[model samples]
Target: MKAMLEGLEYAPEDNAAATTAATAETVGYAFSSDHLRALERDGYVVVDDLISQDVARAAAASARAMYDRGVMQNLRQEGRDDDVAVLATSSLPAGDEFAGLRPCVEALLRVPDDLRRVVARVDDDALGADVVSKVRACRAPDRLMLARYGSESCRYVPHLDNDPSDDANDAGSPGLRPSDRVFTLIAYLNPDWDATRGGRFRAYRPGVAADAASPSDFVDIDPILGRVVVFDAAKLLHEVRPSFHDRYAVTVWTRGAELLPA
Candidate 1:
């Protein structure tokens, strides 16, 4: 497990204790069971109110400030006042800009621990325990913070996180095997998003009518504030729809190391 903590600068000893405490105290037994079932059947589940409103608002503000500053820097570089220049492009902020929002990031990373405890409480290994055990065996967890601004159009095309062609037997390949990508966590920050204002998270299950190798077989997920969506990253094809209003969120992938077998 020491290797699992490598390269993560924020993996402090106290943080580990806090994570364990949080997992025990805050994890929802009923919701975890239902969410695990949803992932197994439809490939995705929306966990409502995972974060409190105050925390979500702070995260949204941080993302907006960081994005706005980045866009301004790009504008200065281009020497243009045209709103079109800013509207047509997107930029990445320095990692430090998001450090304040680390709590949200940690919540996503610890899903395995939460699920494990939940399974213990329920005395079920059918789905939830199986998912957590597979995640633990693999041991490769990755995290990323993504921010999108008004009119910037950071819209992602429909796609699968893992290559559909790859399987467990073909281990040393370029892309992920089915077991590697156990979860895809997206924490939404926008509170007022409606049908008219887009940027919903969309997912598609296998064998669906419109199912291409791509994420075109879409199911729309509203970008509700304090909401977290977790899904089977390999099997669930999903995408971020274009936003009429500004939108931002942290997207993370939790993978297992056994799939890599390095």
Candidate 2:
């Protein structure tokens, strides 16, 4: 609950009330108006030590157990050759894998909805007046997921979560929204993760030209335990770098209800 945010940007003095607005009941993650603006401007934010080490370890065990229990399904059939297994939270069952970790998972899932409401009030884009209409409207997000990545130097190539940034998405299924996703939230569960083992998460700034982007244009986030990352899904290109050791993540994708005003 004590969020020592590692990649937080701009806790500006103008909107100082941001800190007070994000009460525990409104947002358990301690997201401020600054965090919301960071998402809009820089495209990402990283929070470290968001949970206790013990809780992170327990979540890691549960994620691994789910994979061992055949609850996690492979992504090979979807066409990519990466070694990844994922399961939706709605379909996730109650068992030893989720005994005490369920509440945390549920809380993590609710962050998007809660955060949107907070932003809609404190932030200018998230702010409101009787004559003005809301620019960013929060919508129902897709189901939360628990993902386990294999340890055999498996890498998921760089790409945006919601490519094309529209409703006409390719993962064409009534239940899936590979295009409407507005924001992506990921929590690392590996309490003892080794940084040298790789699998660092990377996020790219919006490409200004067709081929002008380079390595320096992106930011890399180490997948350490108790670390949570929130980013703009459609705006920033991201990827899971190769991992020599395994990785566990709880991910939630928030849906985009309206186009952000320019």
Candidate 3:
């Protein structure tokens, strides 16, 4: 959506059609019947093992290493900037610490194809077809970030990500007008996390007025390794509980609009 990839300009020169084809060929993952039902009913779904345990572990390790190296800069939320930060993908080059996780990034790029399928299944024929076409026409996001939440003070408040129109993002950047973003995908990287860790992810019902402190009327997801959570970025109000243990996640967004002129 936002051409500014986490504060750095990155426009991949790959052929769009070819990239889409490749994505379709490689992404064998899909939401189960139960998960699909949950998504339609609750606006979110937690799909375990979206990627292999090995891949998730490797990615988490790589991301944590980057965080330790000070590659991530503070994220600028409207009220707080210390809770989160963008993991500078620019600092990661091939054959570096993040090299092992490249396949995970590519897999994430194919997520829109899965979303198109979900749209087809849940929406009416006309609307589903239109949404599918729009998703197909959208370009994959070039920027990937290791969004890290601090163990002590950092906690993401409940908020919607983006809508079709536009809104400011967590990074305190201008929103993506005619917004292409569709879903929010967060792949948990906490290898041996538990409820005691207190970094649980929660998704609320649509139109709820709850914030981080009052999250009783919601679904809580554990930040365990290899768990990928997908949700309607524009519709769901979600937040992360303050963690006792550090949390790491590979966060990316899926687009649903036609590509815009550069």
Candidate 4:
């Protein structure tokens, strides 16, 4: 197998030093040294207010429109009200219904260059430390937006983003090898969410279960808009609890680069 990243720009002698130094000087929402250390140790970290209210509202509006249109066939078939939950895998909806959300997705992805830079820095650090780097040459996915309507029936069961089975070699999903994910970034777009509203993201730590572990090892962050939670995608097992009210957010996952056929 050939290395997934061959012509990429990460080099320790020259580029890594410059990247590390440049990251240290920037001023914005960032993970503290202590927090970074914690993440390195426990596999996750959370930064509050990563997105602004204007951006959150725009994304929310777009999500709501998409939900109303019944883009997610799974949710509509259950006869659940539109507000219950919405999940957008790639980009924003394109029709007139989701026109407003296009800008919202673009703005959300582009607004925090500094934050994006920090994440890149962290990705580089993970690479250097021999941590599994899942997605190479990718900053973050455009958006994995979700909007939950006022219903408790739309709960996401606990699960890991990556396949955990060791028998992947024998599985039919060719070219897709089993991998241990290193990081996940989740940003909440709902400003009014709280513990009482439910739908709080619950995580269980490693070793908590013989079969399934949770992501709440070191921290349990509430679903607050502008809050970005970065955690070990493998060790941090998590689930979205049901919500009595509406809930909205954008989620992104990062993993170590996968082995590719030569």
Candidate 5:
């Protein structure tokens, strides 16, 4: 696991805990202890001023341009015609408009040791030695998608990024077998987002049934510029509130140990 995070195929026998001891810098936002603590306790955290507003605006324009040009398709759900995205894990061309979004993207791709430790300590007992090792071993994310939910009363129904039942078994022995997402990082691109716009990312607290979740069990965050939301991909039940205006964002899906560090 340690070797995997270090961009290696293998390593000599040693404590996996020792692998992530090396430090990684955060370019988009300072990952303070408070931020990490919030994630450990709440299963999610929202970051403000995540990236420069200028960059976020540029990204939004580029994403919308691409979507308008037909590079993106409608989100694969029934009746959500306006909601669209580039869902593939394809590489962004060098010097493309999306380049400025890289800092926040890379900051998340390079998983921090502190974050690994926090996730390892989650009360879910299924995060046994094996699953915890993958959490510690994972150092990179595998998918980055640019998305837009257009105004037309568009809303995404509740869904989990990864199935909780598959978490313990998501990482197979020795190399990338089949992979499931472990975390989701969404960086909003709209700078002048109005609170009255109505598109908020609402995620329920851990353990609440999505179908039966009460208003008191969730937190709703505005999709504003430089705002980034990250959370446990499998455990948190989340949905997109009805959007009154076009909503654009860059989304990163962390595939634990599925992608060896590059």
Candidate 6:
């Protein structure tokens, strides 16, 4: 279990650590204080080479195998009329499509260890140290999922993932924080990538203007191998540009708990 992270420079705190316990294994990528501040203000931060090249390759290989088996479920944009995007789909860990993805999913869930540390810095008295544990126990399905973008036409338009009106939200459940998906972690497993290849992930600045129809300013991040993007989905707006090449990655959402009744 060696990490192959060369040619990538990061702060001392940016280095990742992993440990296996008797019951569960814990692997976390540490974010510097500066990075935490950026996330607090900008709503997103891209951590370079958070995992070893071998680990990323393994996740990608497993994902590709599952895709070849035709086990993943196709997902389309809420209002789109285009045909199903085989590459633009997700596979849940507990489902049949996840038979070969267990190890990768397990590694992904461990990311919460680092995420909890970051969240603890935000209003610690309010969120508390157990926020991550409580979130893991919530009724919401917070399973690890594989999101693949394989087609040139497959694109995700600018939108919030937790918008109540969206049919893909919490199965239309009505309750406190029905759309309270607190954070999102996307670990890129692609081997080779470039901006010209498309499938760039973009994050917009907050408070653009309520009257404005769309966000104007944003930062685009290339989905390079071993790069992990963490963002607060409840506050930031983002989307995936149409991808010309097949892309594979593991995505997980941290569900926020409701403190009071709706």
Ranking of all candidate structures by their TM-score, best first: 3, 2, 5, 1, 6, 4
**Candidate 2: worst-modelled 10 consecutive residues by lDDT:** 1-10
Q: How many backbone clashes does candidate 1 have?
A: 4
Candidate 4 stretches greater than 4 Å from native = 1-32, 75-91, 95-138, 142-150, 166-182, 210-219, 255-262
Better of 1 and 6 by TM-score: 1
Estimate, for each residue in 91-194, the C-alpha lDDT of model 5 and write its tens digit: 44334543554454544454444456566456545334543554565544444677778788778877676664544445544322223566677889886899
Q: How far is 143's C-alpha from truth in model 6 (Å)?
A: 1.3
Query: Which ranges in model 1 have alpha carbons more than 4 Å from their true place?
Result: 1-9, 12-17, 26-31, 71-99, 123-125, 128-142, 149-154, 166-180, 209-218, 257-262
**What does candidate 3's lDDT look like per residue over 27-97, in tens digits?**
55455446655665688888885678888888887777666666677756553323333433332334456
Note the Cα lDDT for every prediction shown.
Answer: 0.58, 0.61, 0.63, 0.49, 0.61, 0.57
Q: In model 5, how large is the Cα lDDT of residue 199?
A: 83
Best by lDDT: 3
What is candidate 6's local distance difference test score?
0.57
Superposing every Cα of model 3 onto the true structure, what RMSD results? 5.5
- 3 versus 5: better lDDT goes to: 3
All candidates in order of lDDT, best leading: 3, 5, 2, 1, 6, 4
Please estimate how well model 1 matches the true structure, expressed as its whole-model Cα lDDT: 0.58
What does the lDDT read for residue 255 in candidate 4?
Answer: 25
Which 10 successive residues of model 6 have the least lDDT summed?
1-10
Kindly indicate the candidate among 1 and 4 with the higher lDDT: 1
Per-residue lDDT for 53-82 in model 1, tens only?
Answer: 777776777666656555322223121111
Q: What value of lDDT does candidate 3 attain over all alpha carbons? A: 0.63
Q: How many backbone clashes does candidate 3 have?
A: 1
Q: Which pairs in model 5 have colliding backbones? A: none
* Number of the candidate with higher lDDT, 1 or 6: 1
Query: In candidate 4, residue 177 scores what lDDT?
Result: 23
How accurate locally is residue 213 in candidate 3, as Cα lDDT from 0 to 100?
A: 39
